[model samples]
Target: MCGRFALTATLEVLAQMFDVPERPNLAPRWNIAPTQQTCVVTQDPSGRHLASMRWGFEGPNGAPLINARSETAAVKPSFRAALAERRCLVPADSFYEWQHLDEKRKQPWRIGMKGGTPFAFAGLWENATDKAGQPLQRFTILTCAANEYLAPLHERMPVIVAPEDYARWLAPGPAAGDLLRSFPDEPMARYRVSDRVNSVKHDDAGCFERLAATALL
Candidate 1:
């Protein structure tokens, strides 16, 4: 599960990369936690634009489900409708996963595409009401099986939508489901980082401090 992640790209850079005109005054977030509002790219008749959506929607268990398994999202009632029509792209620079070094030794690793280039996670969004009766746009990141490079860390990883497939993914209907495959391991890299990322309070560059040099070849 992509419980914790980061999006450090500037709003100007996100605009250039996504070509979206909506410039919400969002700062660089180095540690985005669940339920926090962040940038999400969604489409409408007006064309693709940026939106600020809180992570996780109300799931069947009455809890905030921030991640969904791509393989079964289509058949799952909680996600079926959104998967069919409300697809979106979640801009993220990197994500974190924990590795079991031993029974009592778990290490946090930051993973992302090589060179820190920004990318989008294939996501599904839904409109729902908050406890106070106000409307809210919430989303859940889709996950697929981990690729060879990241399998040792976890069996699942967020499904990153490639730039070339952005249109196809946001297109109407179930055709977009095919784009949820695990990203290739070659263009990705990972390394040990400070465990401060485990906290929702540590939302700065210090959370990215390197603890080890491990990375993909």
Candidate 2:
């Protein structure tokens, strides 16, 4: 599951990358965790737009789900309707994963595109209402089996949307099922980082920086 990730790019950079005219106030986030607000690009009856919505998936309030497995999202009751009706693309700089070598040993690793281009993660969003009649929008990242590059770091990875496929993924109306496939393995790179990222309290740029030689896991 993608419980934590990073979004450190400036608003101007994201605007240029997404080719959108209006820019929203976006702060750089290095340690984005579940239940936090996140920037998501989605299409409505009007047109395509970017908006901030909560990260964790909360449907009918049994428990918060951070991820929806792409393999079974189409059939699962919790995700089946959303998968077929409401789809969105979540942009992120990179994501974090932990590897376990033994019961007591787990190391955090950072995964990003090779050239550092911002990428989109395929996602499903649901619109639910709170007791106060306030609309609550929640979303979950779609994950597929890890590839050669990410297999060593984790068993699953977000479905990274290719730049060429951005429009198809964000097209209005019915959902796009083909975008749920796993990302190509050759376009990503991963490196070890300090265990400092393991704590949610460490919410700074240092959390994503390369670990020192002596601190390498």
Candidate 3:
């Protein structure tokens, strides 16, 4: 599951990448945890727009819904409605995953495209009220079985929406469901990172610095 990730791209870069007109001043984030606010791209009658929404959804039982499995989301009550109407694209520079090597040893890895290019994850959003009695919009990333490159780290990863499929994903329909599959491993890369990323407080480029071979063990 994609419980933590990062989006350090500039607003201009994201705007161009997602083709949205709004120019919100979004700061770079390196430790985006679940339930925090982040940018998401969605479509409406007006056009595609970039907006901020909380990372997790409030399920019927009031628990945080951070991810929805692509294979079962259509049949899941918490995600079925949003899957049919409120699909979105979650922009990110890279994501973090933890690999357990032993009962007391786990390593955090940074995974991104081979060139560190920005990409979008297939997402779903919903509108609800917050504790402050104000309207709150939230979203959840979709997960699929891991590809070859990520299987060693975890059994699942976020569903990356290709550039060509962005339109179909935001459009209201079931055809876009086909895009929620594992991203190809060839274009992706991963490396072990410092354990500082284990804490949500450390939000900086250092969190992604590649750890030396001797440090990994």
Top-lDDT candidate index: 3
Q: Clash pairs of candidate 1?
A: none
Q: For residues 1-217, what per-residue lDDT tens digits would candidate 3 score against the true structure?
A: 8989999999888888988999987988998998899999999989999999999999778888999999999999999999988899999989999999899999999989877899999999999889999999999999999998899899999999989889889886674767889999888878889899999899998998889863321
Measured over all alpha carbons after superposition, the RMSD of each candidate to the real structure, in angstroms, is: 1.3, 2.4, 2.0
For residues 70-186, could you state the per-residue lDDT of candidate 2 as single tens digits? 989988998988887888888898899999979999988888888766788998898876659899888899998887777877888898888788778777666666777768777
**lDDT (0-100) at residue 186 of candidate 1?**
87
lDDT of predicted model 2 = 0.81
For residues 97-133, could you state the per-residue lDDT of candidate 1 as single tens digits?
9998999888999899899899999999999989899
Displacement of the residue 79 alpha carbon in candidate 1, Å: 0.2
Query: In model 2, how large is the Cα lDDT of residue 148?
Result: 76
Winner of 1 and 2 under TM-score: 1
**Which stretches of candidate 1 lie above 4 Å from their native place?**
212-217
Candidate 1: how large is its RMSD? 1.3
The whole-model lDDT of each prediction reads 0.90, 0.81, 0.91
Pairwise lDDT winner, candidates 1 and 3: 3
Model 3, stretches more than 4 Å misplaced?
213-217
Worst 10 residues of 2 by lDDT: 208-217
Alpha-carbon TM-score of each model against the true structure: 0.96, 0.91, 0.96
